[model samples]
Target: MTDQVMAAIDGSQFSTAVCDAAAWASLALAAPLTFLHVVDNHPQTAEADLSGNIGLGSREHLLEELASLDEKRARLAQEQGRLMLEAAKSRAIENGVAEPGIRQRNGELVETLAELEDDIRLLVIGKRGEAAHKASEHLGSNLERVVRSLHRPILVVPEAFETPRQVLIAFDGSKTTRKGVEMVAKSPLFRGISCHVVMVGAEVADMRSQLDWALMTLNDAGFEAHGEIRAGEVEESLRSYQQEHAIDLLVMGAYGHSRIRHLLVGSTTTGMLRKATVPVLLLR
Candidate 1:
């Protein structure tokens, strides 16, 4: 089967960043990119029922007005979606990416993204929704649900990131880390790029040997990767490393421990997302 990269675009400025990231990956993998825009079904007004207190004729008029507004909103959303897709396609062509396919699906974001996972090598999404609060660093509810449910790797791009140069891979010998490493090793998108494989945790007896094994795996796959072993909390070490290395992208496994453990101890993935200044590639 042909591999594809699926990018979720909602016509926001952040959606443009998502498209750019997806375009880069598409070129790297020599794969097709599919742009998907989901039309959310949630009603715009929760107070529509309150309008019923008026006279029957007025209420009927209000209902008609709401219906007309909804239609106009849907049409505008589709037009914006088309414009964004066209701009992305033009950029891709300029960057030597093949013609990309675009589609507008009418459904919730999470379900649509999950349903498209079978053929997608990577899913690119914005870090926040269009109307998210400025202070929140977390993904919007729709993106979060997709991240938790989809089985593929997700690349979350913030609003201001332009291009990715240096990449940091958060390593700890877990299955998730291994999977992330494999992706980097096999994908052409990371080829000839400077990559740092970081292992963070308290000092262990076989840390050197573990690092050696990880390095060997990358070397065997023809990736020029350097290893670093740090003694501290995972999140703290990651932040320090990013600043020191000027990392543009952070690649790691999503929440290595069990849900119960994560609830009690918190997760490094969530911590990094909230604190780090770069984009994150999280493998599930």
Candidate 2:
């Protein structure tokens, strides 16, 4: 079976942009694309009255209004999701992807996604979700939570990217870095794109071997790849390289070392996500 590319759609305008990116990846990877819409069970509710002095009819009317509003919101959400899925499917078909699936589930976001992660090769989500405004710099709570929880690669699509021409792979010779390299080697999402494998904090002693290993792996996989080893902070080196090379997208491991180690010593993963100017593909 072809690997599945899963993308979460929240019925927001930004979601359409995410779908476009997912479709591009699905086509490139020759993978079936799955569009998932998760209806939040924890709908916003009005504050409860501590004092029961109000009349029964007033309370009944308020409850009825809330129910009606929830129903309307749910309907709107489903409609928007359906429309976007249809558009995405159409685009995928145009690009030669066959029979993409669209699914909707009503439940907690994190639970539902966790359940689906087993079969998904790639999880695509927008940088923000329904509640996020176009001007917001920080990611939405749902997207952020998923990133922290899911042990999968997530392509966080930004608002401005239409297509990726150049890719930056953050290499550190860790297990996660190997996974990221394997992903790029096998997946068509990176085909014909210029790949720059960057190693930060490189000592002069082993830099040659490390660079050679990376170059050999990528070349064996039929990718046009290059390597650069730099000394200094990982985040700073990556940012500088991005600026000089005009990198369109960044691919890296989500967290390196142990969780305890990451907590005690700050991680380059966290730093790059906060500071990167381009879209990031994070592999866990």
Candidate 3:
């Protein structure tokens, strides 16, 4: 809805990748970039009421000490957030972002994203955060919430940065992928890249026709358009297509119809993300 790319920064191994992806999205969309760092809210400890309840006892002294420690921890967190933002801004600038905006807020990340949703054209984030930095089998804690909470497109960087050469869009002819088609057709985001639009189960009554219409739409928008109709499992089919075509970026609708079909969790999107070696551009 807005003309800015929002990049969420957590001081994890994936931070640099996120910044690079944000820079890429900003350039592609020809929009400003904003790097956001969230200093998560910490709940109240047993210190505030100590002065009253433990009336001049040793317990009060210990509680007051704990309170001071909590204050120090909060200060350290603020400083760390500032440093992370500075580093992310530097990365973005180095990756061709002209001038990037910085926003450090104190709250939950999802709530912060919800507040800024209306001003975001694209959201860039890491696939995992520090809490899930296993690099083996962990996914970001807030990935699903952020995807479901925000309506704008999200560019998720899994590994290090790679400039996208060819884009593969996994289409199902659903409203979501139709929206993706409209986005590619009307927006500057996929402007100069070749697009391969593929639909699984094209033997269905209207699937082939739908793919044709999508191809026509992309052709009209000046894309080097290619379409494929494959009959196989959705996630595996898409992965094979991307690999066969040597695609660098994977674009698709965020999920299917029901919450049960979410991509971020134990759904088809999960399998795709697990097997995908490239970055994902997810649209809802």
Clashes of each: 0, 0, 0
Best of the two (1, 3) by lDDT: 3
List runs of model 2 lying over 4 Å from the truth.
50-52, 133-136, 256-267
Give the local distance difference test score of model 2: 0.77
Model 2: residue 140 alpha-carbon error in angstroms: 2.1
- For all predicted structures, in order, the TM-scores are 0.90, 0.86, 0.89
Which runs of model 1 end up more than 4 angstroms from their true locations?
47-53, 256-266
TM-score (C-alpha, index-matched) for candidate 1: 0.90
TM-score of 2: 0.86
| Cα RMSD for predicted model 1 | 2.6
In Å, residue 136's CA in model 2 sits off its true spot by 5.1
Q: Point out the worst 10-residue segment of candidate 2 by lDDT.
A: 257-266
CA lDDT scores, all candidates in order: 0.78, 0.77, 0.83
What RMSD, rounded to one decimal, does every model reach? 2.6, 2.9, 3.3
Question: Which has the better TM-score: candidate 1, or candidate 3?
Answer: 1
Pairs in steric clash, model 3: none
The lDDT, on a scale of 0 to 1, for candidate 1 is: 0.78
The lowest-lDDT stretch of 10 consecutive residues in candidate 3 is: 257-266
